[model samples]
Target: MNGVHAENLGARKAKATRWGTAFLVATAISVLFLVILVLSIVSQSFGYVLVISEVDTASLARNGVALESQEAPALIETLKEGLTRRHLATLEEAKPLESRNREELLSLVMMEIVQERPARTWTLVQSVFQRKAIFDFRDSDFPDGRLYFRSWLRASLLANPQSSSALDSGLRGAAIGSLATILLTLLIAFPLGVAAAIWLEEYAADNAVNRFIQLNIYNLSGVPSIIYGMLGLAVFVRYLEPLTSGVLFGAAEKGAASGRTILSASLTLALLVLPVIIINSQEALRAIPQSLRKAGLALGATKWQTIWHHVLPASADRILTGTVLAISRALGETAPLVVVGASTFLTIDPVSPFSRFTTLPIQIYQWTSRPQGEFKNLAAAAILVLLVLLLTLNATAIILRNRFSARRRTNT
Candidate 1:
């Protein structure tokens, strides 16, 4: 009997050892792939490009000092002199050209007037190791072209607006549209989802109808996002066009369509994330100890009062963990927004919730689908911007979660 017992214990120990080794290997593989992805994105974001403006850059220079070195006012004057009246008016309509800073005006001058475009490009690795070879090839093959070390990721990418030329394009419009859409989605979805979760976790009786609803909620979370886009197209865009388009409120702008505004897009995203929030919130609420409720009841607190004051505060951090996940998913979603009518080539910023919109994901998609190497570089830079924005939002949520955890600890 002693020998058999010892053998059983040894077998259990061997199994545990195998499982631990497997888990460690899995974790190592995940980290390795993550590092590889980061390296690949960084490789595309910095390099050397052969830039050749159609017009000689020095011809536009102020007293041979260079056009790029000019002041804002001078650059604006140059734009006025070089651009057509219609083109000038289009630029002014977005923002008063005079109000733009020096660098922006310079970009405009280079893009619109000089027509500077990337003629050829090389990756950072090639640019560094094959410097002599690249220069020799450039001089022999295309003497008119000039070489410059260009970092695709730059301050200008964030500050400037979208453009027909990849060199002049920026993510300002898409970023602003993303912020507006995501914030509004949270406002519309968070409360409703939490309320549904509370009902399901605290009040709903286990019955056929309730079980059906629970099953549907779980299933909805896994549905393709594009389905929500179709639902929004039918309901918000077509059926309730007047409301979503702001026609009912008499707030529609000159060119507002039946729908397809940020409001419609946000509503679609809200539906897409609703199940995720509810499931997470329900789990959070469930984790709170039953004794807390009993204690509240013993103190003569009503069920509603206990839930609002005690139960919710205890689970706030966990609930916010779900919110962070939903927000991250919404930030990177492209197909739903595309199907819901996100403008693919928009330059002007959305002025209101009822305005047409786009997002970082959409911009990245469009840029990547193009045939140019420069556009691919731009796409890589946009991915970095999206990652930074996601991290910033997640950091903010984490701080709030920590505060809630601290407050809950103090209360207990």
Candidate 2:
């Protein structure tokens, strides 16, 4: 009997070892996949172009000398093939760089070429990308130009807004708007959701009424974000016109009415994410043993006091974690924002609360929908930005949760 028992125990230990090894292997593979995905996106974003500039030939010639190149690169052969000496001189003499006022410069270049050579004259336009070449001069008669490679990548994050492309799309406006929206959502949703959870878990009975409320919360969580967009359109955009539009900028006009304003977007997102906070908070509150609450109450504490002193402190880590997760969700959401009428194009940085705005996801969408291959690469880069932001937020939450857990254990 002892020999048989020993054999069985050995078999069990081997099985446990096998399962542990499999688990570790699976986890490693998953991490590796995520790493590769991120690297791919980073490479694309860094490689893509974002802005194009039109150099004013007359102005540039007046300011600086345009040295002639005997041989242009093979890629620019098409441009060089049809160019007359005068056009080439004009191209060389044009301003080598102009960062802002791209549209005006492009128009000026096109008009100058048209006036000088009534016949088709190819004009050289410069492009900026991030990390790579500073200027890419395209040989074209049309005013159209695109920023490619490294300069574009950097510009996408630094640029304010542009007429033509996502390369002109900068993170400055989107990033700030996103940060403000997230902060507002957290301020509005976290406390309210958590308070409701506390009330439901600590005070409310598990009666039909509470069950009904719980059911509704779950349902609301599942409701399509478009519905919430519609809600914002009705209440915030229409009825609360003063709050949404008039209060900030005298009502939704040409640049308004899309409900694309940051405040509207933020409030709409808050509604979308509120249920998540509430649900997670309730679960966390429930996890704290009832005995702990009873112990505090038994010691002559009121219900609110028991919760404030004992229950809440114990569940603090989980509550914080839930809030962070909700924020992460809000960060990536594009559909609701689109439904709310986020502009795919905007040059001015959103200043007043009611001004139109765009986000990273919308930017990516604009890029991908474009016919150019380079734009697709820009989209990939935008995705990488979002992923990094989400990962950073989540990592911070994990660290905070760990710290809280450690402190709670020490106190106990």
The candidate that achieves the highest lDDT relative to the unseen native structure: 1
Worst 10 residues of 2 by lDDT: 115-124
Q: How many clashes in candidate 2?
A: 11
| lDDT tens per residue, model 2, 316-345 | 999999989988988888888887777776
Candidate 1, residues 1-412, lDDT tens digits: the string is 9999999999999999999999999999999999988878888888888888788888988766788688998898889999999999998998889888877788889889999898888877788898999899789987988888889899889887888888889999999999999999999999999999999999999999999999999999999999998999899888888988899988986666669899999999999999999999999999999999999999999999999999998999989988988988998998889888998888888989899889999999999999988999999999998998889888978888899899887876
Off-target runs (Cα >4 Å) in candidate 2 are: 1-36, 48-59, 63-152, 162-168, 247-254, 257-259
What RMSD value applies to candidate 2?
A: 9.8
Residue-pair clash count for candidate 1: 0
Estimate candidate 1's alpha-carbon lDDT, on a 0 to 1 scale: 0.90
Model 1 misplacement above 4 A:
62-65
Model 1 compared with the native: what TM-score? 0.94
